[model samples]
Each structure stands twice: as structure tokens, then as C-alpha cells.
Target: MAEPTLEQLREQIDGLDEQLQGLLNKRAELAQKVADVKIATDGDAVFYRPEREAQVLRQVKARNTGPLDAETIARLFREIMSACLALEQRLKVAFLGPEGTFTQQAALKHFGHAVETISLAAIDDVFREVASGAAHYGVVPVENSTEGVINHTLDSFMESPLKICGEVDLRIHHHLMLSEHTQLDKITRIYSHQQTLAQCRKWLDTNMPRVERIAVSSNAQAARRLKDEWNAAAIAGDIAADLYDLKILHRNIEDTPDNTTRFIIIGHEEVPPSGEDKSSLLVRMKNRPGALYHVLKPFKDAGVDLTRVESRPSRSGNWSYVFFIDFEGHRDDENVQAVLAALEREALDVRLLGSYPRAVL
Candidate 1:
């Protein structure tokens, strides 16, 4: 067989395009039917299921045999599902912000761009919005690969009744940016969130050691400050740089290249097992000779994998501490159940923060 002519190739592409359009429409129609069936059976129906979406994305990645990478293909499917769910109900997502914050980015990344994002000023405000039924979900920074953990977020969980339904790990890149008013040589000061400053500490020290560094509430807030401060630049991300119309003076200025922050999804309802899932537990041990040993021995006995463990000073007293832990299996699993039973016997108190699907994209 000879190579096909340009006209023949064009015709083939056109046919495939038509078929793809038809199939996409068919999928949308089926999704609408599913919504109708749900509404008929239950007056109040949930269109978004974290477990279901995780399973679908995992399968999409697993079954893929193509030129495109699995992440790219999974993202396309994510947007498609997001659009379909929007038809049923536009989910309101609240996140720590003034907009253009990384938390906002994480929320969009996890829920898809179809969600209506509510940018609250603080993490507590995010919890309030979701708790008050103003938003369907909330996203807040839990920890950073570089900076250990976010204490405010961990502390919030102690009082709030929200459950962690999903998690998103966002790769962070900091850029030293300035507006037209701020020239490279004339730059007098630098501004960023305290965490952002710490993240890019080494870069700033080497490049602009003499510049006055100011910490603000959030990176987006730092970028906002740049508009008024003619001689100041801000260290922020792509979203903030674009939102504030700042030029990137130096891109990826973080001290570490692999700096990433983990965010958690907060909602009122608990998520069911998503096959490959992780459960978080808030444990408080009775004051004893071997508190830490008793806390960890059960997982070893049950043959469960532990991911992370952090200690926070207990608000109840000056000397006590609470353990925030993440581990392999869901609460519903047999092994996990046995571990929980052992915990009840060993610890003063144990709270399952929630079992949720691990980050897929």
C-alpha cells in the first residue's frame, strides 16, 4: 500500500472528529439520564462522588495505551466529568484565598474548573462557609513537603466536624515578580506570605540579599500590595503574577525544585472506600511509660502501612499532645477495623479524621 494523500488524511481526521463529537454528546446524555434517575429516587442527590471519580481516573490511566501520557488523558476525563456534573448542580467550593492563592488552585485542580469557588480570607472562614451550607466543599493546605505541616489546619480539625473526602498535592513554583512601576534595579523591597518567603529563602538570599523582605497574609495579598508599592516586588506563583499583571523577574525561585504542598477536601459527609484509599486518625494517648510505642505497635501487628504522623500540643492542657496520623487502608477494611479496636484499648482517645481517596493527579 502507498502512503495516503493529504486530502485522504484530512478526510479521515474529519470523520474521526465527527465520531468523537457524537460520542461526547452521547456520554453527556447518559450523564443527564443518571441525574434524572437519582433525582427520582432521592429528592436530594449528590452529583459528585470522590470515590467514583478516583476509580474512573485510575481506570482511565490503567487502561490507557496511547501516545498521550496517562496524566494528560485523565485530566481530559476530569474536565468532562466536571462539565457533566455542572449540569446537575454547580458545586460551590470554598478555599483559603483572596483569589489566586495555591489553595484556590488546589480546589480547582481537585473539583475541576466547573465548581463555583468561594475565596474566603482565612482557613477558618473556609470551614465556616462549608459548615454553614454556603459551599459544598472546602480545600485547605494541610502540609508541605518542605515546611512540615500547617498547624492552623490541623488545629481546625480538632474543633470542626468536617471530614476529609479527598486530597490534592500541588507542585509549587515561586516566582519573583514585579509590576511596570517596579524596575529591576530600583526594586527596594520584596513581599510574600511568610511561608512563601521561607520556601524561596535561599534564592532570595543569593539574588536580593539587601532588599527588605516583608511577610503578608497570603501570596495573593503580597501581589496586591505590589500595585501600590512602586518600588516593591512580590514572590508568588503564576496565578498571582497573572492576576496582578506582574512580570516574572525570576521564575521558579524556590529554594527546592520539588517543593509541593498537600491540600485536603473538607465536607460534611464521609466518603466510602475508593479501593486504594488512606485513612487519617487523630490519636491522644494516655500518659504512660510507653505512649508512642502503644500508638504505633497496633499498626505493626495489623500489618498496615503508616504514611505520616505528627504531634501537636493539646489545647486541653499545657503538657498533653495529640497525634495526627495517616495510614494505608480505609476504616471499613477488616485489618483497619482490628487496628482501630486495638487503638481503643491502647489510646486515651482516637478520632478518625476521615478515610479518603489519595491524590491521583
Candidate 2:
């Protein structure tokens, strides 16, 4: 086959570009109409419909017949949804720490660039931001592949009344970064967030055993501080690298390659099921041997699958722990509701953190 000339390729691209533009405009028109109908008939316009989004992605995946894979197509449509949502309403989001952090990156990835994000100093700040209506939604790390559950987030849930609207699981990649003027061999100290240090424990032990490890509030902040001095490195992701004007000394420096972090989106809305659903709850049981068993009996009898169960010290009473439980199913489901009703009779307190559809990406 004869190879196409550069001019011919450019012409073909031009034609396809025009067609894509037309299709996008048509889609936007339809979206506006949909928004109008929702407002006139339902009395409110829902910019994000998780169920509709899931169906759209699933259909696209089923109908894919090109070089683009399902994941690629889905991400494209996710941006499209974000654009349409912005046309209707731009959502404000809160995430942990300063910019360039993984949690902020995950928030931007899932919510798209249209969202206005506010970086918070603490996990509790994220919860409070959403609870006080300061931000439409908040993102916080729930669990990580290596470090396990973030107990601070779980404990904050016990104090806040915000609901889990969705979730985003992001693959974490930590990098060893340094200023342009720094020499790797002469490095005498490393700076990073405590979790980042913990994540790259093996790398640090093998490569820089004698070097000092300093813990900062976040990896991004540590990277920012690296610019002021030499003989020091910071462990952070690509965002930090670019923001701090540092070079990547080593990539994927974490102990494990399968590192992942699960983040929960907290909001006031109860997101409808997108075919899959997960609900969060806080349960307090009496300080007795069989008290915990009694609380879980209803779920066992009802055949409810518990996804996660974490215990945090209850400040209300001595020796009591608040159990933060995540399970599969909406709180409104008959079985789930029954289990909760039964649990309420035996438990000190039970709070439903809203039942929402599981996030696709």
C-alpha cells in the first residue's frame, strides 16, 4: 500500500475535525434540552447523573470498534460530561492538602478540570468543608494498598454528617525528586510526608540507609521546600516534580508496584444507583463481649456483604469503639433497612452515610 502524503493526512484530519465538531455541538444542544426538561419537569437540574453516565460509558464500551479501547473512550466521555456539567453548573470540590497531592490529582481526574478545587490542611477540614456547604463535595483518602485504612478519615466520618456520594480509586506512583543543582550521591537528607516515607521504606533503606528522613505535612510541600537547599530529596509524584522544578531521581520508588489509593467523595446529595452501589455507616455498640457480634447478626442473617469494617475509639464513653462499616447495597433496600432497624435496637447509635452508586473510574 502506498503511504499517504503529509498533505493528504492533514486533509483527512481536517474533514474528521469538522465532523467531530458538528457532532459535539449537536450533543451539547441535546444536553441543554435535557437540562431544561429536568428543570421544568423535576423542579431541579442535576448536572451529574451517575446512572446515565454509567449507561453511556457501558454503551460506548459495547459499541467500540476502533483503535481506542474502552478505558480511553470512557475517559473521553468523562471529560464531555464535565464540559456539559460546567455548561450547566460548575461544582466546587475540596481535597486534602496543597496542590500536587495525589488526593487533589484524583479529585481533578474524576471531577474533571472544570471543578474548582480547594486544598484543605486536614482530613477533618475536608469533612467540615462539605458539611458546612463551603464546597459542593469533598475528597479524602479512605484506604491505600500498603498503609491500610486512613483512620483519621474514618473517625471524621463519625463526627460529620456528610454522605459518601461516590468513590475514585487512583494508582499511586511515588518519585524521588531533587532540585537541578542537587547531586544524588551527595544527598544527606530526604523530605516527604510521613505516608510517602512509609510507602518508600524499602527504597530508602537500601539506597540511602544513613540519610536523614524528615516528615512534612505533604509530599508536595516537601518538594516545594527542596528548592531552597541542596543535599536533600523529596518523594512526590509528577505534579510535585513539575511544580517544584525538580528532576525525577527515581520513578515508582514505593515499595510495591500495585500501589493504589481509594478516595471517597463526600456530599449532601444521595447519588442514585448506577447499577452498582455502596453504603457507609457508623455503628456504636455496647462495651461487652457479645455486643459487636449482636450488632452484626442482622447483617449476617440478611445476607448483606460487608466490604469494610474499621473501629475507632468512641469519645462518648470509655472502652467503646465506633465501627465504620461499608457494605454493598442502598440504605433504602428492604434487607439493608431491616438490618439497620434491628441494629438500632441493640446499638448505641447508628448513622447512615447515604447510599450511592459506585464510581465507574
Candidate 3:
């Protein structure tokens, strides 16, 4: 048998493309039908189901066998689902932003581009927007690999009655950008958020030690400032640079190549277990010897894996302390229930923040 000629292969490729397009349209039409059924059953149905989407993505990744990686394949499917969900109901997402921030990137990453995203000035505002029903969900940075915990985000969780529905881990790449009018030789000052400044501390010290560094509200804000200034450059990500129409003087200026920031999805609804999930809890231990041990012993006994445990000064009193715990099991799991019951009996106060699927894409 002779190998197919270039013309023959091109014809076959076009045929496959046609078939794929038809199948995609069929899938979308079915999705609309599903949405109709959901609305008929429940008038206030949530079109975006974190657990369901996670499960679908996990299955796609697991079943993938192709030249493309699992993440790439899953992303293609994510956009499809996002489009279908938009037909059902467009999601309103709130993020910490004046626009073009990492949080905005994470929100788009998790929900896809179909969501209607609104920028809030602060983390607290993001939480409020979601809790007050102004937004269906909010995305906020919780921690960065290099900068420890975002204390403001942690504190916001203390009072907010929101649940962690999902999470996205974004690899941060900071670029030194300047406006078109700026003179490269006369760049005497740098601007960025305090955390961004810290993440690129070593890089700045070695490259531009004599230049003055100023901390701004956010990297986006810094990028905006560079639009009019001639002697200043902003260290920000690609989004901010593009948004501000600035030129990149240097790319990936962050000291650590693997710098990553973890952002969480906040919503009013409690998410069901997605098989592989993580639960977050807040516990206020009584001020006594072995108080911490009492709070954690249940998890140890139940063989539940604790992912994170951080202590914060309790707002109730000067000397009192509260712990934020994240573990690798859903609240609905038997072991998790045992742990929560134990904590309730032993701790001064215990609150379950949420049980959400682990990040898939």
C-alpha cells in the first residue's frame, strides 16, 4: 500500500475538522437542554458547579492520550464548558483588582473567559461582593510561595461567611516595564506592590541598587503610574504591562523562578465532595497547656492529612490565638466528620470554612 500523498492528507484533515465542529455543536445544544431541565427543576439553579466541573476535568485529564499534555487538553474543554454555562447563566466574578492583576488572571483561569469579572479595590471588598450576592463568586490571593501568607486575606476569612469552592495556583512572572516616553538610561526609581518588591528583592538589589524603590497598592497600580512618569518603571506581570501599554525592560525579574501564588474561590454556597478534595477550618483553642495538641490529635488519630496549619492572634482577646487548618479530605468524609466533632468538643470555637475540590487545571 502506498503512503497517502500531501493532498490526500489535507483532505482527511479537513474532514476530521468538520466532524469535530459538528460534535462540538451537538454537545453545546445538549448542554442547553441540560440547563433547561435544571431551570425547570429549580428556578435559582447555580449553573457553575465546582464539584461537577472538577470531576469532568479530572476525567478528561485521566483519559487523555495525545500529543498534547493533560493540562492543555483540559483547558480546551474548560472553555467549552464555560461557554455552555454562559448560555445557562453568566457568572459574575469579583477579584481584587483595578484590573490586570494576578487575581483577575486566576479568576479567568478557573472560570474561563465567559465570566463577567468585576474589580474590587481590596480583598475584603471581594469577600463582601460575594457574600452580599452582588457577585456569584470571588477570587482572592491566599498565599505566595515566597511571601508566606497574605495576612489581609486570612483576616478577611475570619469574619466572612463564604466558602472556598475552588483554588488556582498561578506561577508569577514579574517584568520590569516602562512607558514609551520613559528614557531607559534615566530610570532612577522602581514601583510595585510591597509583596512584589520582596519577591524580586535580590534581583533589584543586584541590578538597580541605586534606584529608589516605592511600594504601591498593587502591581497594576504601579503599571498605571508608569504611564505618565519618565523616570520610573513598574515591576508587574504581562497583563498589567499589556493593559498599561508599557514596554518590557526585563522579563521574569522575580528572584525565584518557581514563584507561585495560590488564589481561592469564595462563594456563598457549600460545595459537595469531589472525591479528591480539601477542607479548611478555623479553630480557636482555649488558652491552656496542650490546647494545640487537643485540637490536632483527632486528625492524627483519624489518619487525615493536614496540608496547612497557621496560627493568628485571636481578635477576641490579646493573648488568645486562632488556628487556620487545611487538610486533604472533604467535610462529608467519615474521618473528617470525626475530626470536626473532636475539635468542637475540645476547642473554644470551630468553624468549617469549606470543603472544595483540589485544583485540576
Candidate 4:
């Protein structure tokens, strides 16, 4: 057989591209048909399913045997599905934001760019939006690997009637950015969110010890402040930097290299069990000796793997506390049901936050 010429290779590539485009449109048409069938059966049928999406993404990854990496391929398909889902019913996602915050990035990361995002000023606002059906879902930061739990988010859950639908883990990368008006030698102050400042504490202390550190409401707010302030820099993520058009003075300034934040998706509907899922619980026990032990004993007895347990002062009584517990199993699982039954028997008050699909990407 003769070796294929460059022209022949180009022609083959062009033919494959045409086929791919046609197949993509066919998939889209099928998605439209699925939407029609759902609407015909029920007027208010839910268009998004976190469990379904998780299973598809996992299958896409497991079925891949390609030059493209798993995560890369998974992302491409996620966007494709996101587009198709939007065709059914465009989703609205609310997140903690002034427009360019980490929570917004997390929301987009989980829901994809096809959805419309509503940026709210506070985490509670995000919760309210979802609870009121103003947004299909909300994304709020629950914890940072370096900074421990976000008590605010946990406290919000104490009163809110929302369920955890999904989870997203975003690797945080903070950059020291400056406005065009400022130069490195001229910088005299640094600004960032309180948690962000703490996350990059050692880095700031070692390099800019003399500069005054000020904490703002958010990283995006800090980035926006740099626009008019000539002698200042902001420690923010790429989304904020790009939004504010700030020049990068330094990148990845977080003290810990692997610093990541976990954001939970809040919605009105409960997520079904994906093969891999995690459940959260809020339990309040009588403030007495062995109360904590009793709370933990069930998980051990049931053989359920507890992922996290954080205590917050109960709003009801003095010295009383509510524990926010996370574990590695779906509520429908037999072992998890056993644990919940044990807690219900012993605990003064208990609430299942939700069982949700764990973060896949």
C-alpha cells in the first residue's frame, strides 16, 4: 500500500469533522425529543438530574481509551450535556458573589456555562434564592482544606429548608494582582477576603511583611478596589483578575500548594443515589457527657464512614450544640439507614441535610 499524502490526511480529517458535527446535532435532536416526552407526561417535570449527570460523566470517563485525558474528555462532554439540558429548560444558578467570586466559578464548574448565574452578595441570599425558586440551585463554599469549616454556611443550613444536590471541589489558585496604575515597587497595601488572607498568611508574611493587609467582603470586591487605588494589590483568583482586568504580579500565592475549597449545591429537590454519594446530617443531643460519643457510636456500629463532624452552638439553648456530620454513603443504603435509625432513637433532634452525588471533577 502507498503511504498517504498530506492532502489525503487533510481530507480524512475534514471528513471526520463533518461526521462529528452531524452526530452532535443528532444527539441534540434526541435530547429535544426527551424533553418533549417529559413535558407531554408532566407539565413540571424536572430537567436536571445530578445523579443522572454524575453517572453519565463517570461512564464517559470509564469508557475512555484515548489520547485525551479523562478529566479533559469529561469536561467536554459536560458542556455538551449542559447545552442539551438548556435546550430543555435553561437553569438558573445562584452563588455567593459580586459577579467574580470563587463560588461563581464553582457553580459554573458544576452546572457548566450553559446556565444563567445570579450573583448574590451573601451565602444566605443564595439560599433564599434557591428556596424561593428564584434559582434552580445555589452554590456556596462549605469549607477550605487549609481554613477548616465555613461556620456561616453550616449555620445557614440550621434554618434553611434546602437539600444538598451535588458537591464540587475546586482547586484554589490565588494570584497577587495589581492595577495598571500600580507597580511592584509602588505597592504599599494588600487586600483580600479574611479567609483568603489567612490562607495565604505565610506567603504574605514572608514576602510583603511591611505592607498593610486589609480584609474585604470578597476577593472580587478586593480586585475591584485595586482599580482606583494605585498603591495596592489584591490576592484573588483568575476569574476576579480577568473580570477586573488586573495585571498579575504573582500567581498561586496560597500558603498551601494543594489548597482546595468544597462547595455544596443547594436546591429544593433531593438528589437520588448515584453509585458514589455522601450524606450530611444535623443532630442535636442533650448537652451531657457521652453525648458526642453516642452520636459517633452509630456510625461505627453501622460501619458507615464518617467524613466530617463539626459542632456549632445550638440556637435553642445555652451550652447546647448541633453537630453537622458528613459521611460516605447514600441515605437509601442499608448501613446509612441503620445509622440514622440509631441517631433518631438517641438524639434529641435530628435532621438529614441531604444525600448527594459526590464531586466527580
Better of 1 and 2 by TM-score: 1
Better of 1 and 3 by lDDT: 3
How would you encode candidate 1's per-residue C-alpha lDDT over 1-361 as one tens digit per residue?
9999999999999999999889988988998999999999989888889999999999999999989999999999999889888888899999999989999889888989988999998889988899999999999999999998999999998888888999999999999998888867888889899989998889888989999999999999999998887789998999898888989978999999999999999998888999999999999887667778888999999999999998898887767788999999999999999999999998778889999999999
Tens digits of per-residue lDDT for model 4, 1-361: 9999999999999999999899999999999999999999989888899999999999999999989999999999999999989999999999999988999999888999999999998888999999999999999999999999999999999899898999999999999999998877988899999999999999999999999999999999999998888899999999998899998888999989999999999998878889999999999999898889999999999999989999999999999899999999999999999999999999999999999998999
Candidate 4 lands at a TM-score of 0.96
Model 4 alpha-carbon miss at residue 39, Å: 1.4
Model 2, span 1-361: residue lDDT tens: 9999999999999999999999988888888887788888876556776566666777777788879887888789888878877776788999997988999989987888878999999998898888898898999999998899998888887667788888888999999988987877889889999988999999999988999999999999999888887888999999889877889978998999999999998988777766678888899998989877887799899999998888889989999988888999987788998999998998999988878767677
Candidate 4 lowest-lDDT run of ten: 179-188
By lDDT, the candidates rank as 4, 3, 1, 2
Give the lDDT of residue 325 in candidate 1: 92
lDDT per prediction? 0.91, 0.86, 0.92, 0.93
Instruction: Write out the backbone clash pairs for model 1.
Output: none
- TM-score of each prediction: 0.95, 0.93, 0.96, 0.96
After superposition, which runs of candidate 4 have C-alpha atoms over 4 Å from their true positions? 1-9
Q: How accurate is candidate 1 locally (lDDT)?
A: 0.91
Lowest summed lDDT window (length 10), candidate 1: 284-293
